[model samples]
Target: MTTGQALVAVRDGTFLPGPCFMPCVDALLYRFRLVPRSILVMGPVGAPLLPP
Candidate 1:
């Protein structure tokens, strides 16, 4: 999926269900106009690190 599609998936709450509550994804997935490799993490602004 691309960013827009991913956004829609998220809005529809159909992205995924997980034990982690949220998903950990690659940083590159959100790059504009790029094909999505994973879900984009958004929240807790200024987080020092992303999931490994």
Candidate 2:
């Protein structure tokens, strides 16, 4: 999806539209790891994706 679409998704889910590190992919995955908050990152389909 485009940035606008992403922004809409973020807003719809009440998520922080932090920034898209990966522009090639549209899917954004959020998960809690090192902090007490959800961290957004690119999926494995994109570069430097998070491990499963």
Candidate closest to the true structure, highest lDDT: 1
The backbone clash count of each candidate, in order, is 0, 0
lDDT of every model, 2 decimals = 0.47, 0.42
Q: State TM-scores per candidate.
A: 0.24, 0.26
- Give candidate 1 misplaced runs (Cα > 4 Å): 14-52
Across 1-52, the per-residue lDDT of candidate 1 in tens digits comes to 5999889888557424532354333334455535454334333443446552
Q: Per-residue CA lDDT of candidate 2, range 1-52, in tens?
A: 5999988887766533323533222332223233322222323335346333
Best candidate, TM-score: 2
TM-score of 2: 0.26
